[model samples]
Target: MNPRNILVTGGAGFIGASFTHYWLNKFKNDRIIVLDLLTYAGNMSNLSQCYENNRFEFIWGDIGNSDLVESILVKHSIDTIVHFAAESHVDRSILSPDAFIQTNINGTFSLLNAAKKVWIDTPKENNQPVIKHRFHHVSTDEVYGSLLPNEAAFTELTPYSPNSPYSASKAASDHLVRSYLHTYGLQVTTSNCSNNYGSFHFPEKLIPLVITNVLQNKSIPIYGDGKQIRDWLYVDDHALGIELVLNKGKVGETYNIGGNNEWTNIDIVKLICSQIDLKFAENSYLREKYPQAFAALSGDSASLVRFVTDRPGHDKRYAIDASKSESELNYRPTKTFEEGIVMTLDWYLTNDDWWQSIIDGSYLETNSKYMII
Candidate 1:
């Protein structure tokens, strides 16, 4: 297996796509094989720009497909893997945990099993090995459960106490990844990160939802008092951190990546509103026209934010103690919350098609009952 060949699972989604794009641009010498099932959230439209690149290859497949996983690994001579495929939304996981279990739990084990066969069977380098491969698990901070308002953020030593089905599922995946390293002696590392908000993000998340809602003059919904606090990390910076960890991290260790940008849910919504007003003032003609189908698609401004019921088991605060990754891997977010928020709003405005289709398709599936929980 060649070191230059790497597999990035779920590369069509938000963070995965961003990371794939970044690597495609920066590491022209390396190749990435992206495997995504193209679930409602995974769309080829996002990666259309990278289709022509020889270093990047997109495969429509599930991580749990053992045959497909083994075939891709052997065919590509892949020696590295960045596992990013998972059902990540806390609210969605609350409604149905089955998808999370299948994708996040079973899917990861399938990959690990394939890797064990490939790595163990390969020739070893005297004391080292012929194929130097690594499995990097991308994870979330929610696995640590909620933090009290005045309590310290989640650090590496924080014990596992996941609240929602989503976090529990992720916590389970994290454990499996770690266990593979210890029990199987497979080369693995894990990173738990803060909330990532940036371009190409799904509308189910907060920042994009707020930006898109305000763009349509819809009321920005806030849960409870909207006082829940979260540490926001720009996806780009998080990508950089992950890349660094993949290349330079100690096997079996876990690193926490965050933006150091913390904000209450309400404050973020208001900030987005202010940015929207500025955008409208700068471009009055588009402002007069607004986005196409704004009235028919979403709704009026106040209707935008209808807080019917709070999501079950919502966490109060989630602040990442990202110093471990920062001090160890030289990772830090260059964009502050203000800058990242503005950039996100601008991206959404410029690339409405990317998100509009997501909302449209999501609306169509709104009637489908949740699978399991």
Candidate 2:
């Protein structure tokens, strides 16, 4: 296959960064231009290793900026766009829905509009072969909303029943992408993934939050009995899933990407706690730095678990049915929950400076030479 020039929005964020690394490592000749808004969740250090690669370029910008989006597309001769930028946290959306609406809804519209303008409406280079451009949208399973205890997992045909402002915004964005594909004939594919956990994950999310709280000796907040269930997908597996979709998925189709590993909120916390306890037991040096951690003492890490009032409009459960992607794209998640959790725990334990900087608000002060568009 010929090398493709790809534009990746939100490539500095967790899942996007993972996809960026996966793509660059696998497709060495392809060039990638990352466009991110550098919001609180966007960590430049996540892509620090990519700086040395001549094929990779980082641009500090927003997907909502149509002019910048168009400029990058035309300038780089981009043939593929992997859209991942959005306001993703449910708690933050409940407190402030405006950012969610603007970023998730309007921002997606801007990207679609810019792609249509440049890739479809504009004139192509003289004597050049027709380039097939693709627009891949990364979405979350929350758009399917809560499921009853025995309800089947969400499929591609699942009717969206978004409960929170965050999910509503994402649902709307998903619709916008679909419209562009049907209305303007833009090549588009969407993947709705289960909860992703791995390195460079913002500490605000559940997995990272629990891991960091344990390391810091802080209370691990479990909302409203903590029975909320989510299917966990390792970030790398999600990246691989996207790669399959981009390479083989049909145009104008949506695929569900899941790990098929489901666990309740409280259960997840307990698992992390036990893992940390084992880590502390095996490594004596951890006790010195995290002296106050529950495991560092002779106490169960579960002792730090605290039950907090649940957020408004909390979804009771979310599970994905990735059979469509599995059969059609021949995709499957390689990491089991056990292997993924162990890897995630080791990442947090070893990379103190990474998460520590985020906790102390030092990661935001990124003094770098990456171009800011």
Candidate 3:
């Protein structure tokens, strides 16, 4: 099926924005429509460059809005759908599980129902022709629960053992997507990705959060000795993985996307601190004027590390076995952890205003003020 027009949900957020921009360039001939709720995490500015393209359209509405989604299907003739819209921040999910359940679980249900109407009602050209509709759902590796340090990574057939409100909600949605494929004969595929870091990232996330705080001479909070481990994948690579799965992947299958780079909480923070120090203080012109500052910051970068109360239900470790994606979909991560950290650090160092606005009053945690780095 040649999908001339496609609809991408949550295209205004971090990974979503990257996906939207990536796809527009990858498939220049196809038109793309984006739907987002523009919640605290969603910002239209992420996709502002694509706004003027005649092939791109955005609707500022929630996926849970059945009437709105159904209308969009009719208006755009969108045959391919890439679903990324959700309440994604784990911290926020811990604070308010209600919002995550509403958007992640219930919203997915609404999207499936709306698509059934559009795909089922279309008049058939001939009995020999199969339905050309495609539904790609974006998900996370957290749904597989924590892993031991040397444990094997998660695969396509891993059991659902989500530990937090955020993962649990995503688990439910993943089930719904799979059920639709089997029961209603909906064409669907899903990808569970590792931690993503890159440009246009929200401040609440770890990479941006630590980078922002360090720039302001603030303490970098480390939860529970900072021992938790995660596989960090660059957002652009992740965006590419999603497109690969949607395009060449088998229907009714789940794929894992991992960069094969693993780091503990402390190591990631220290790596960013070292990168920032070397880039700004030693590598740049400031080396001449602030040689002492460079030595002090680098030698004692650990001073900024502060062990804070751990998050409730925090997973000790997470890893993804992405061999399926690598072999079948020809997917591979383009960025290493070291290179990705430098890129992330440079972005925060350069773009202060973007993250500063998010760390202001309402979103600021109580510990955000008192820590010293």
Q: Give the winner by lDDT.
A: 2
Better of 1 and 3 by lDDT: 3
- Single out the weakest 10-residue window by summed lDDT for candidate 3: 364-373
> What's the candidate order when arranged by decreasing TM-score?
2, 1, 3
Clashing pairs in 2: none
As a whole number from 0 to 100, the lDDT of residue 257 in candidate 2 is 97
Stretches of candidate 1 exceeding 4 Å from the true structure: 1-3, 122-130, 289-306, 362-373
| Candidate 3 wrong stretches, greater than 4 Å | 1-3, 122-131, 283-301, 361-373
Q: Taking the tens digit of each residue's C-alpha lDDT, what string does model 3 give over 1-373?
A: 3647888998878998888888888887898898887777777667779978889987778898888888888789888889999998888899889999999999999999888767764444333444478999999999999998889988978898999999999999999999999998889999999999998899778888777766666778889989999999999899889888877899998999999988898888888777767666455553443344433355455477789999999999999999999999999999888888788776766666567666773423322332221
Name the 10 consecutive residues with the lowest summed lDDT in model 2: 122-131
Higher-ranked by lDDT: 1 or 2? 2
Ranking by lDDT: 2, 3, 1
| Alpha carbon lDDT of each predicted model | 0.82, 0.91, 0.83
lDDT by residue (tens digit), candidate 1, 1-373: 1237889998878999999998888887899999888776776766778978988888878889888888888899988899999988877887788999999999999999888777765455334564678889999999999999889989999999999988988899999999988997889999999999888898978888887776655656788888889999989998898888987789999999988878998777767766666666667664665754253233333335555456788899999988888788888788888888888888888888777778778522421222111
Listing every candidate in turn, what is its Cα RMSD in Å to the true structure after a full C-alpha superposition?
A: 4.7, 1.7, 5.8
- How many collisions per candidate? 4, 0, 0
- lDDT at 146 for candidate 3? 93
Error of 1 at 343 (Å): 1.0
